[model samples]
Target: MSFRAGFEETWRAVLTSRTLVSTMLLAVVLYAFYYPAPYAHETAQRVPVLVVDQEDSGLTREVLRDLAATRGVRIVDTVADMPSATARMRAGEADGIILLSRGVTRSLLTGAPGGGVGVWVKAAYLLRASAIGEGVSAALAGAAEHRLGSAARAFGLRTPVRVIQEPLFNTSAGYKDYVFPAVASVILQQTLLFGVATFFAGRREQGAPPMRRAAFFGAWAAMTLLGVFAGFFYFGFIFWLQDVPRGGNVPALLLTVPLFAAAVAALGLFLGGLFDRSERAMAVLVPTSVPLFFLTGSAWPLDQMPAWLAALAHLVPSTLAVHIFVPLNQMGARLSDVAGMTMLLAGEVLLYGALAGWLLTRRSDTNPR
Candidate 1:
């Protein structure tokens, strides 16, 4: 088949096959809503916390008031002792506990080393626990500062330095903003990968002849186009609707999309050539999604991964694409900033496209259409 004929045939096959349509198109839409549903609130808010105020002093009360007013925490109830606070946490009544020890007020006022505030968080959910810890810590810090400031003023002295914190990129530091952008790239790769693999594998199962160079390129192009569409759907609409942090360099992001899609499509075509049946493609590829996501270094840093594993991760298109897209779309990085990685992605397109073409060409020789 010629390039145009192969392109048209692949498009027709994709549109006609219920399996392909569901895997490629429907799955993208479904995941766009489903994957991010839990993170809809963006950041944890008003996380219930129990306060164990062993010292019911005026200072402790002021700290509790500030803690209750914080966006991340709410003082659901004040308990008499540590045992009661622990019981409430175990019963799921609160996400965290704050203990103002008997001499905490004295410690703060005198700068003594004896008694201090203690925080206990149910670490079952790290993000919730972090929010609770941060909120409680902030309140305690404010109280401590106020006590110290009063003493400083009495002595006619001033604090030499004050630290101001400003979060970068994901300013809210919400789980959705931190995670969804990277996962979106994985979704784009996996969907297109599964779709293309299933499509070509099904053809092989039906005893279809192997595609020539032009035909292979044509089919690859078709899949690449679909992948690009799915990517933009996430980058353009879903981010906006979900209110995930965005506003990166749009033109740079646009330029990166096709390179990412083409590389994934080529990888899919190559993997599809190995499968004799569509079922085999799904069986092998489905389980790989989670592992591939980890390899992207979004949830975990590549530097911390074993050196070999980190190096190997670069072979996956989504890894490179995540690095490229996250910086461009989320961090507003310039094209030149991501130029090296973009070039690497283009290299993947060449490497995988060559392998896929060679494999298909060999198959054509044996099948002898």
Candidate 2:
């Protein structure tokens, strides 16, 4: 049979198998439907706080009022000392502890630049600790500035120069924006990895020939591209057609979107060749997908992860693609800066496609039954 005939045969075989058809359609929906991100509440919420009012004065009461009122923070009560606070944290009642030094009030009233204060957080809840410290410091800074008053002017404490910190890529920091596009590739990669297994299994069981592999691959790519565009357009339009302030660059996204689909399809091809049984491939893929998503820096910053794991994590295409698409959408970076990202994505498709193709070429020798 010619390559064209073989491809038609494989495709027909694939379509005739309800499992493949259903899984393919399901893959499209999973890729297209709502992209979920790490919940905000997961990062910080009802953070238990223990305030040590060393001053124990009216001024400290005002400070307590301010900290308690802050969102996502709950001032449980004051501990007798740092030791007590530490014990509570160990007991799971508190997330952080703040120690107000004896001179906290005096330092503000005296118009001093520095105040004596100590803040400690449970080792496990360091993030919540840092946030509590920042909130308390901000409140104190405002109070100290007010007390400095006219003296603050003489000392140039209230300098006109304001250092404004702006987050570029993750402005709204919506779970949808920060996580969706990156994770989309992860889901894509794994599904295709397992999906091609299903595709090839049915073909092999029916004694299909390799002559149509190209046609099957071509059709598969064409269909997959349609799904890719569908996902991008659906989500991109959700922001643009709805006039949301999502801050995505439409043109850049157009260029970057195709790489992910291509790479994912190539992954599917690689997986199809390696597995004799669809069920076995599906089993391996399930365990692999979780770590793959975790490696994309969704839960923790990649920099903070262990050095060895971080080095290995970069090998995944989803890692590179996620890092690229997010910045393109959020930063609207010019072509020159993003050229490297583009290269990484394109490279993945080329390398992985070649690998999968090579594997598939050897399929007949492997004895499918």
Candidate 3:
């Protein structure tokens, strides 16, 4: 077969194959809508907290008002004691409990250790817990600063240094914004791999077709094009729709995207060639998603992982691709900044493309059954 003929055949197969059309293309669209739904709000808001004010002092009241004012938390109920607040949290009416002891204002007034504020947050959901805790702490800090206003200034009791915070990226500090870019990279690799695997595994099970140079390279070209299409659809349109932070380094992305897609497609073809049946590819590859995700060093830092494992992870394209894509796509890194990973991705394209082609062209008896 000529390259043109092979390309046409592969294109037709992609159009006809449910695995490529529905599972890969349509699924990417569905995932775009569904995956980011939970993150639509960006951050949790107005988390309910039960306030217990035994002191009934002006300071405690001020703290309550501040808590209510913050968008991150709301003063859902004012209770008289810890037990009642605890019960409210347990009943799911409140997400946290804040307690002001009886002598809190008296102690502050007398310059003696007298009373304190206690905060109990539901730690099961870390993000919610953090937002609630930070909100309450800010309210308390502001109230304390206000109460000590003139007296502390008169006594020259102010700290010499003031810390001002300005977050450079992920400015809203939303969990979705922080996590989705990394997850999207993994999704691209896995969906492309699975779709291609299913297609080739089906071919292998029916009986190994005569390996022609054109057909083999044409399949590779077709899968790479499909993979690139999937990458752009997710990285371009989906990320825009979700309002995820993205950089416009088109040149850097253009270089990285094709390399990553080609490498993933090559790897899928190699793996698909190893499988004797269609179901076997999914059974083997689906379980690898989680392990590969962690290996990308998004969930856990690569330096912190075992040295051997970290070294091994570099062999997987995503381990390197995430580093390249995340910086180029989300962090707005320049092409020069992503040069190393760009080289790595290019290397994967060459290495895997050669391996896949070699495996496909070899005698069927040599391939695993």
TM-score of each: 0.93, 0.77, 0.88
Best by lDDT: 1
Give, for candidate 2, the lowest lDDT window spanning 10 residues.
34-43
| Models sorted by lDDT, best on top | 1, 3, 2
Give the total clashing residue pairs for model 2: 2
- Alpha carbon lDDT of each predicted model: 0.89, 0.65, 0.82
lDDT of 1 at 366: 60
Which residue pairs overlap in candidate 3's backbone?
A: none
Q: Model 1 over residues 1-369: C-alpha lDDT tens digits? A: 788998998999999989999999999999999999998877788999998988899889989988988999988999988998899899989988989898988888876777788888877878888888888778888887787788788899995355678878888777988999999999999999999888778877887787777888899999999998999899999999988878668888777899999999998888888899999999999999999999999879999999999999999999999999998888888999999999999999999999988877676756643
What would the per-residue lDDT of candidate 3 be over residues 1-369, giving only the tens digit for each residue? 666776777789879887678767887788778877897777788888888899887888888888889988988888978888888799999888888898887776665786987889888877778878878778877776777765678888883243467656786788888888888888888888988888788888999664566678888888888889988888898888888888867887787888899999999988888898878898899899899999999989999999999989988888988898888888889988978877878888889888887877766334432
Worst 10 residues of 1 by lDDT: 360-369
Model 2, 1-369: lDDT tens digits are 334554465467556767766665566465554444234332465677887777787677777777777765788988778778888877888777777878778776764655567766766665576567767876666555555565658887674343355656555534455556566667656655566666665454556544234554564565356447544764475445432235566677677777777776777777666666677766777788779999988778799999998877776877876677656655566556678867977888888778766666555444421
- In what order do the candidates fall by TM-score, top score first? 1, 3, 2
| RMSD list, candidates in order | 2.0, 4.6, 3.3
- TM-score of candidate 2 against the unseen true structure: 0.77
